[model samples]
Target: MPLKSPITVVATSLLAAQALAVSVHNWWDVPSDFGNIAELQSSIRVPQGSDPIKTYWMANGFGNGYMGMQHNSDTERRILFSIWDDGQGSKVEPIRHGDNVTVGTFGGEGEGAQSYLVYDWKAGDTVYFRVQANVNEAEDYAEYTGYWGTDGQTWNLIASFRAEKQPYWLLEPYGFLENYGSDQSEIREGYYGNFVMINSNGQHHTPENFQFTHTDIFNEYREVWDQRLVEQGKEVYMRIDGPADQGAYPPAHH
Candidate 1:
């Protein structure tokens, strides 16, 4: 249950040849045994990328799933954290609050709206993120907080908001790598480790504590290996190969 970016459409017509769609995600969802989650924290190596405007990675913690850390080709290669609300009913979108400034907003077609805040993060730095939830007793609401910093010792508050709808404490966390540009030569890589989720009752869970599954954008009828994940000891890593050889393996772990 990593954060899922809105899918991008690269081609509009069959005549468009090279403007094919491209995207990849590696995810690990919280199992039913994990129960209600209070907070999730992880240290992710900012991927080495050639084009800052075309390739990116996100290490995220999901609450009510629509929230967590984000790094994309947009916003000039800065880090972002966002909170989202279901885009239907009496819920107006959550407004930006706290010390975090708004970087962007996304919502449409009956989907929830996401308000993102920016941070100065460079590639190759080991950035840590934490997504935690709290309840406002007066209003009987859920507040989600996002934090980020170098390593995991110190954390800077990034963003927080009260969900339009009360969110339960069940954080389903995941990580993903994507290359949106048409250039197939540029490769993006991220090493995700230290995945820890604290359940509502304050029980902590790690990658070593649960069984995981690997998923990719594949067409079983035609056969394609678009993306995947592999477990390296206690840590998990991801690879995004462009639509090509289904038999090609992920690049050796760095």
Candidate 2:
């Protein structure tokens, strides 16, 4: 079945008052590998600012088992990476030491090599590093695919490729469905809306703008659900909220 057209809904209460700046790009583009080694590095010369800087990296596991980082150090000579084996899952955290920390090979099966890392800055800091790799096998594409979180533990969705085209992809926060409990009768009686759409561009338009073009898209989608409900002698209602505040992710380094 066609996946439900992806939708992003944000709660008003969670919106932030200030706008944040974010810039993303791929730093490494190479053939996926099983044993061949590669290094992805970047340097952001820290400028003067009070914002904390945060860096993130992840492997997409295309032709390789997974992506891992090694030998990470800041100008301050601090060990940002750590190696640990939790028995349940063995991987590096913060940063890993030793020249021998090896990431497993993906055995050349599905997506070749995919991974990514991001650096969040407060305002004027420069950071740089080389993400090195050790590969044994190789594939065609090695685009980065991963997400980072405010805390190391919980992560939000960052980006992913479209199923077939593979050329088209999207980047946004993870979405969720709001469940209105057992009151089936209440489904249509009061305010009943299934989804919310957020335009990251922050451009708000009236119903007329939507009626001419963008508006028709949602109307069509709503019609589909309405038809199904009507067939069952049920009632369904949908409401489109404003270009509500789409909260920004925490700055990478603040």
Q: Which structure among the candidates has the greatest TM-score?
A: 1
Query: How many residue pairs clash in each candidate at the backbone level?
Result: 2, 46
Q: Residue by residue across 1-254, what tens digits does model 2's lDDT show? A: 22222111111111210121111211122222212223222222221221122222211112112222211223211112211121223222222223322222121122222323323322232222222222112321222223323333454332322122121112112111111122111111111111111122332211111000001222222121110111222211121111112111111111
- lDDT score for residue 4 of model 1: 21
Residues 1-254, model 1: lDDT tens digits: 23222111111111121133343344555667877677878776645552245654566635343333444546644555654444334242444443655634544312333455565566667778787877554554567777777879887766666665454453445555555455554444556677778877888877554323223234441122233334554555555443333223544321
What candidate 2 gets wrong by more than 4 Å, as runs, is 1-37, 53-79, 82-127, 136-254
- What is the Cα-based lDDT of residue 13 in candidate 2? 11
Candidate 1: list runs displaced more than 4 Å.
Answer: 1-21, 29-31, 47-52, 63-75, 89-100, 108-120, 135-140, 209-233, 241-254
